[model samples]
Target chain A: MTQYTAVHGEKVSLLRVLGPGHVWALGVGIVLVGEYMGWNFAVGKGGALAALIACWAAGMLYTCVAMIDSEVTSTVAAAGGQYAQAKHIVGPLMAFNVGLFLVFAYTMLEAANAITLGYLVQTVGGMAGFADTHDKPFIVLTIMFLAFLNYRGVYATLTFNLVITAIAFVAILILFAAVSPWTDNVLKPHELLNGLPYGWLGVLAAMHFGMWYYLGIEGTTQAAEEVRSPARALPLGTMTGIITLLIAATMTWYICSGLMPWEYLGQAVTPLFDAARLTGSTPLMVLLFVGTIFSTLASANGCINDASRAWFSMGRDRYLPQVFGAVHPKYRTPFRSIVFLVPVALVFAYFAPLDQVITFSILSGLLEYTFMAFNVLMFRKMWPLGTIKRGYVHPFHPLPAFVLLALCATTYFAVFLGYGTQLVAMMVFYIIASVWFAGHRYKFVKRGAQFTMPWPRPVGH
Target chain B: MENLNNFQLLEYAAWGISALLGLWMLTDMIRTNRAHSEETLLSSKEGEIEDSLVIDPPHQGGHL
Candidate 1:
């Protein structure tokens, strides 16, 4: 049996595993892709401000879920993430389903990021030649690069994320400064009121796009086990990163709007680049293009690194194939999971359109978040106040938990109602998972496989 | 519309109430630890600590 050591022979403290700047970078990386790619399609200039508010609200809700999860798992910080946490709170049958969706969420997100990276490479001036005949090849190269970095382990991945995020930030600041002259153009009173006719329902519907910008707030929680001091670092990193992303996203939206007309932005394929052109500086445009490329790559890398861990954890628990669970002895990482994920991402990147992939990715992620939010509520009821140790708690108790549960479920159902194709696809995927889990259960029972229940028995006999 | 805004305000007030509830939960966790330690002392005196710590019945495998 291989023994797992907490420190892994390193004298690093939890704070040492991450600094505030690193946390900010991770948070910014999470939001930038959505802002750059999905924001226009999700919401227009009038709806952007509302979307920002929605993102903050969603961030708070996700933060609450993470708090409950950290306390429940004894702060073990496993890669299995919510799948591992769900298995402990709910039963394996439910967790198996959650695990399947979790894998789908991360893999789909990887595909989305890779496809976006390909487009960015093609559109950016210097790299246009690379784009002409080599779209799929570019995606494949990106997948390979991300997979290798992730396979190296968490420290290298976070360091790379920090550097990429810093570059992206500086690029955004330059773009903002260049566009500052057009600040008046960006803050149109009419644009802010454009969606007013739709009333609250329209605003809420438009929030679907806003929520996309906030999608990855829960990502760092998945890597809680890899962080040095999960108990303290997890909450601090998560909250700070979320706040930073929220501010950056809001500012980016404002800057872009200020630099161009709402009509142009609404139709823009690459709005930020267009905003850069307003500055009339070739050097700055080049920097922005490079930043966009780095942003997509960093986001893809983070998704793959976190997703592989979740898959490996499921495999270790026998919910997935045994091969996925095998850690590379030398690398101390899940080499197989990383290997499997990259190809799947590349296939989707090559075959699917960017918009379709984004929709599917967001839909799958929404389902997983709904399940997780529900699990938090369930854990609160089952474990109650006294069962756990001192860990961060959500500001509002059952109320915030209850409100998030309601809003998340409502949004999920609303999306299902609107997007019939995605609903059908999600149903088919769940049905397949159900059949696989049933088959696995039969085989295990026949072979007398040992079962480990999620919860520990009451303290004293 | 104004009434609805008031309702939103009320909802915010409710959130404030819940924040207090969260603080109460932290206090409860502290109280539970003290009680657990006392229980452990009594159980140890009665030679029940080891028995309680051990997993009963050989572990069995199946969907958990």
Candidate 2:
């Protein structure tokens, strides 16, 4: 029998209550705040100017990815985002892998945010020696708290995301205003060119850290199933979100690099704080710190929301156990999956070193990016233009997807040469996922109906 | 311990992700062809059943 309800016997569906603003909030909210910390590490690798170049490239990369993603989501309108799109273009096995990797990426990113939150609290509170053990509780608590926000309902979580996202952006703008007057010498050509210290290779090195500036823009599609009129909302929300991020990224690089040397900025964990301290303004430093906290909270909260949806989608499709597919009767949310992810994230945060976690997260994200580009190519061939109504048609045919795929392939080779162990770990993860999928096929088919690809095409044609 | 540059890491990921995709697509094509052939056979069987029903109707008692 075809299952009419959600898996686990619940007659539940994700409510389509989100609008363009909410979509924008989710998109920007997930990524905008990285300027406060991780992206600065790129400065160390490539000097300031090189890092800036890397950042710009990453922004372009995101813009391209988001544009293609917008087109796909507008048509697919499924809960699992890239995974769902994969189903239309590829086989079920591929879709299962996409969904699993997506969940891993989001959860890992969430854990990174939680760890950063712990560090931020430690810095602001002057908690020396507390990081060795005390940070664990803080990280765990942050995860649980974010999970609660998502479990309440989409309305509550998204409304909170919108409010906090606005405040965070305003805080960044205020920092810009404060730094502008002191930027005469800071913005000089000599200072900007100082980034070439490590030479051209530094530019490549900068990409890893620089990517943090706009890493999660593509994640917006994960919310498509929850959006009202996703075909219309996705493009508007994603385009606006990326443009805003680009502006914010440029302003941040200019001001932060201007105030301090690339080397100094690279070394500072709280780059914004160090920049404010340069002005001899105590108030500005405190305000920037507060903004960092808000941004961290928003990123973690948004990831929890997105990750649970991916997990729930998998469970609903019977790729995993159905228990994870259960929805809250009162809240109309995937409450079980949200609850399940908390401990898993905490374990990762507690055990893994921060840099390793970051590396792993980036790899997982790249996997999704790779396949999304592939899917775009395959989907266009399957449902050629004019066949299906499109929400947003990317003007240039296959160019963006081809470029993204090429970038991903080359970048993977580079990462393997640079960091073999992490590369091996990612490969191991895929191997394990493949094994589990093959073994579980029998159970999946017996317990749940097989999912059909919804895109229309004549089989023989 | 030298840290890998951002671009290199990206390339590394691309390598792994793309390789896996290539492998999966190859298998998917094989599966799709099998399914297509099975569907063709099923459709042919249905047509034969329809022909049998039309060409040979039930006989009336004794007159046959």
Candidate 3:
């Protein structure tokens, strides 16, 4: 028995309609086409062999993050995802930080998708003479269009996710067919061994691009509150999504890299398109183009859905304004937060460079990963064993979390050293969040808000 | 500094916007606190749950 009291006194709560399939769609939709565009940039950083090595490392990292996150979701099962878990496992202030980081990460990723989709449309359609600046009109329209669909309701949003994710899968299979004939001719055995053009350091530098392969798959947790049966569905959906992504990532790497020179693909704005073109098939390029469109649209749409839920959860907890926490009376969706996110995404799409936007998005996600891993350990320490029944538990408690923490720190350090400016920009964003958290603390104390950690105490302790 | 390009300029603008957002949140917090009084703020237990919904130990996996 649960209810919501919006600031305006409107009755609001999220409807539980999503099942395992929709959960899987939400998880995979946000990251289906990583091998399409931004991932090619990794080849530029680390060459073909080094990039593949980086990809394998990132895949393992995502597996750990996903398993640990599945366990956390089983406990909290709240819409705020990591933010909600952090509040229960850690405290309110850390939850606030996680909330803001989640919002920034998802919104930036959405904007990047819109920007790249615009570029793809221009390239695929062969539009001429509009290169004076990035296509602001196209990007803005895409954001508004996705936000509009989101505003309609969650059912429409998830339905769109399911459809497009299927299309993306089919598109990849066709793409494999397009590249298969040429793979034997163009792929060199020597490139496989001697292709570490930038050496070991390049692997570190290329990690962000490697992360593109499975960056947002853990967004499955964000859907915990909306799923029909969180206990059973969350673990199954998320684990299935991870395995699917790993297969897609491996296949995308092999076929795309083998079909064309890794150096050339590295520089390509649209890697799949370049791979299709290499086969010299007009129909194949068009097929891959459709897949690219589906992939970008699904990514942008799912980001809005996930980010708005995070914002809504924070507002419900009084971290943000109560207005942000409000769900639409008729649709039962977080319309205000979803609407607010549209313009912010459009602003980024218009002003920020695409590569910088991608880096910042991944960086913010890594920060959230570090916090989530820490929260896992905190939960174990506080709850101990046999105290609570969990549906899915990762083996060797704390080991996976520890490994994830080390990987996150190393990746952040690499990004700071390689891309200093974006790192600084994110730090400034964190500073602002900290300042707001301080003010929030002042308000909490002034208003005498009750604080409680929702963990059970052992009798002796 | 002399060779600052459009992208650099954009980054500065983004930083400025972030700073402004911080100030706005702080001020909004103060204003909300002033408007509602401690009594009204404490009356709502919107997100708090009655019992601890801690994670249950797995039936299969060994206890931590």
* C-alpha RMSD for every candidate: 16.5, 15.0, 9.3
DockQ of each: 0.01, 0.01, 0.03
Predicted complex 1: DockQ: 0.01
Residue pairs in clash, model 1: A14-A229, A77-A225, A186-A258, A449-B61, A450-B61, A451-B60, A451-B61, A451-B62
Go through the candidates in order and give each one's C-alpha lDDT: 0.59, 0.72, 0.73
Best by lDDT: 3
Better of 1 and 2 by TM-score: 2
How high is the lDDT of residue A317 in model 3?
Answer: 69
Over A1-81, each residue of candidate 1 has an lDDT whose tens digit, in order, gives: 322222222211111144434444554565566656566543452354454455565555555554554454333345566
Q: Candidate 3: lDDT of B19? A: 49
Considering the two chains of model 1, state its CAPRI-style docking category: incorrect
- Candidate 2 chain A has its poorest 10 consecutive residues by lDDT at A1-10
> Residue A205 error for model 1, in Å?
2.8
> Residue by residue across A344-434, what tens digits does model 3's lDDT show?
8978898999878888888889989999788888877777667877768888888888888878877887687678888888888798877
Cα error, residue A309 of model 1, in Å, equals 0.4
